[model samples]
Target chain A: MAEQVTRKPYVREVPRMLWFLRHPRYMRYMAREFSCLFIGAYTLMLVVGLKRLAEGPDAWAGFLAALGSPGAIVFHLFALAFSAYHSITWFRLTPKAMPVQIGDTFVADRVISGAHYAGWALVSLVVLWLAGAF
Target chain B: MATSNKPIVWGPFAAGGTLTAFLTPVLILLTLLAGLGHAPDLLAYDALRAFAAHGIVKLGLVVVIFLSLWSAAHRLRITCYDLGLRADTLVATLVYAVAIAGTVAAAAYLLRLNPV
Candidate 1:
């Protein structure tokens, strides 16, 4: 451990919002991380749906009606696009954060990332099938 | 040095991140479909209610909702910190509280959903 000094030390502050602007990767990472807000918002909306359902059909119907509004539709469109970006970046990053090893050989990052997309497709298909969207 | 119990929250945050990555886009599209009035018959009020009325489905919803909420909470907290919010304790409490409350509300509502 270094000895503590009584002399004043120089310090520099990073511009919080624009800090990531310095690097393309940081910018992309920030954008990816920022997608969580939209995800959270959508989840809250789902919770609202659940609440409406629990309140009975009239409430649920009202919720559905609200969902049909132009504003809601537009928001959903943007949120969907933004969320897709978030999802893609997230999948790419997943392999880095959570790595896999098999029989003394580490799996390739792209393969792990591909697995994320594959799983997403699989789950979405099941959900769509069960929901009778097909 | 003071100890920080961030690891506790980080665990769920990480799990939630993974779950959110997989489900968020699908959910967004589904919501859009519903909003556009092209919702499948199975997703209509009566059918959707019946689908959600299953105990297993409700259980899964609870888990997904809980994890996703926590994940979002932790993410937002970090974002806030990065964005120059110096109140770590306050931000953590508020964001995490929202996540926890949302999870509790989801579980409660899910439990109230009667089986058809």
Candidate 2:
């Protein structure tokens, strides 16, 4: 009787140098993390506004006056770009954060993101209208 | 375990994302207003003072403060995890703990009847 040998499946070890470059998900995770810097800066601006409000009317006026400056406008634009990126990506992650279900069926991530965009659009419209922008 | 062992990228996206999440819309509105060249009269300080004096603005302020703080804290927790901070669970707990404390402080400040 001849002895039988059992062969195991071959598994190749991935090179460290190629791992991140080869993985799209890791790249996205990185993009997501970097977005926080803008978030922190914008939050500070709001906090400044709040503090001005706490100070008194003249101070609040001064704050708004400062906001109207060209420099402030530029800052606002930069803030807007980062913010928009954050919102879209955050919504993209919504399915993972809060999985939606209806009648024993799971809703798709795209649907969830779309709904969020629609909702935000409606809210923006309403806010603009209330502000007499339209 | 192999899947979990992969190194992740933790960089500008984290900070940018968090900032963008809360400030983007407000920036847009501000930009549109600026573009219109209609620099509205500065918000009356008396109005804010009045609200603070009355308690409504105080409450609103508190809510905004707490919400924004908590959101930032949560994002920071995830950012730390992405940076290869192995004790993610511990960091997350600490982050939430700080957020809760800040939130409670906000609420307490708002609920006080006396105004200075």
Candidate 3:
């Protein structure tokens, strides 16, 4: 029989709500991470719209009309704001995730972030142009 | 197993996160503004449908949707873990399944478009 060793381990039980409030960084991280939920919702909406488009004109038009509702408008507004937060925070984090080296010197974080913004603008313009909305 | 490889999911999650970083805001703004009936001439249903009829455009849409959804799923899985949902494997599986399902549905629909 193996001898039993008795030991008590101390465990910390943290209250899940307001867990980030104790630290500013945790709060920001949580805010940025949670914004993905809004992004996901918007993506799901686009998928539905795409399916409706495939279903032909009436379904597509119905989706458009549904988007005009007060509730949808409100949700969309919130989604837009959250997505902005998500984009900005993610852009800020990109440099840390994938650092760019220019020659022997490391690229500045701001430069990397700036390039991301520039690319974003150019892509947005292209998408707009392709859709003939520009 | 706690030692299970996470990089498989992480790679897509990171890529998806990056993709959404660039595109989500633009999509939301355009969609909501169009929703409010301010859709520009180029964005009218027929025009947008026409745009989707291209193979390259359809492929691009699939890539964007897949990455964004997968990233969101990864985020949700982390959120669940943080919230004390101790069953990491189950939560991860469930969330990832949702992302996969959404991506498959989106791809199927995009493929069904009239590639003009």
Candidate 4:
């Protein structure tokens, strides 16, 4: 009888990877998460302002002073960039989150995003007016 | 391995739901305290501080903070996975572990702060 040849189990050097990030679904998800960075930072900024409010008048003034500093101004500009990205992505997602159908007629996603942009524009005008910047 | 058609459920929702169920009452209590609008007169400090001092309140906050953080971390991991970022099981586990730990530390620090 011929000797039976031993067979070794095959092991892949690189494991079978799930390519989720490359998927379009993942690209959208990542964009949303990146937007949260702005939201988190904005929240912290407000919290710091609130803490200063609780501290006293001097602290509050100091907080306002810090906000006007060159570093703070740069951070605010960066925050604005993130905020814009966040706003666009968030509004774009609104249609998915709350689909609107009027008697079997589905509303367009562009309509939703456009409505949000209009609303923000109105809000900005109102805020600028209130701040006497207009 | 064959994949199932059923949607994969995460653990944080189950844990967070249980935690939130218990925390809701405390949140209501805190809301009521804050609503009173005389925290200084009633508690000599901020309403949040007053609420933190109570045993049940503290426990409720701890539960809320940790569970919420865990839930956020789990969601963040899923988001990262969806984005085609690092989606290894080890990384996901580490993300949640760190989030839970950070939340616990934050709760502890908040509890230790003396109300003024």
Best by lDDT: 1
- Model 1 - which docking category? medium
> What is the TM-score of chain A, computed separately for every candidate?
0.79, 0.68, 0.81, 0.71
User: Which pairs clash in model 4?
Assistant: A21-B83, A21-B84, A26-B82
Q: What is the lDDT of residue A134 in candidate 4?
A: 27
lDDT by residue (tens digit), candidate 2, B1-116 = 34642122223234334334544575456534744466322234553344455667666655555555556666777777656576887986786676567656555544543465
Candidate 1 versus the native: TM-score? Answer: 0.89
Tell me the tens digit of each residue's lDDT in model 3 across A18-111: 6777889988888887887898888999999999998988898898888889998998998878877887887888899889887998999999
lDDT of 4 by residue, B33-79 (tens): 32333222322334434545566755654565665455545655666
User: What lDDT tens digits, residue by residue, belong to model 4 across residues A1-134?
Assistant: 59877998898553223443557985665665554344334434444444554455577557656665676656655655554554566566667867889998889989976786677566655534442332
Residue B56 in candidate 1, Cα distance off native in Å: 1.2
Model 3: docking quality category: medium
Question: Model 4 in CAPRI terms: which quality?
Answer: incorrect
Steric clash pairs (candidate 3): none
Model 4 ranges with Cα > 4 A deviation: A1-31, B1-116
| Interface RMSD, Å, model 1 | 1.4
> Where is model 1 more than 4 Å wrong at Cα?
A1-13, B1-4
TM-score-wise, the better of 2 and 3 is 3
Better by DockQ, candidate 4 or 3 = 3
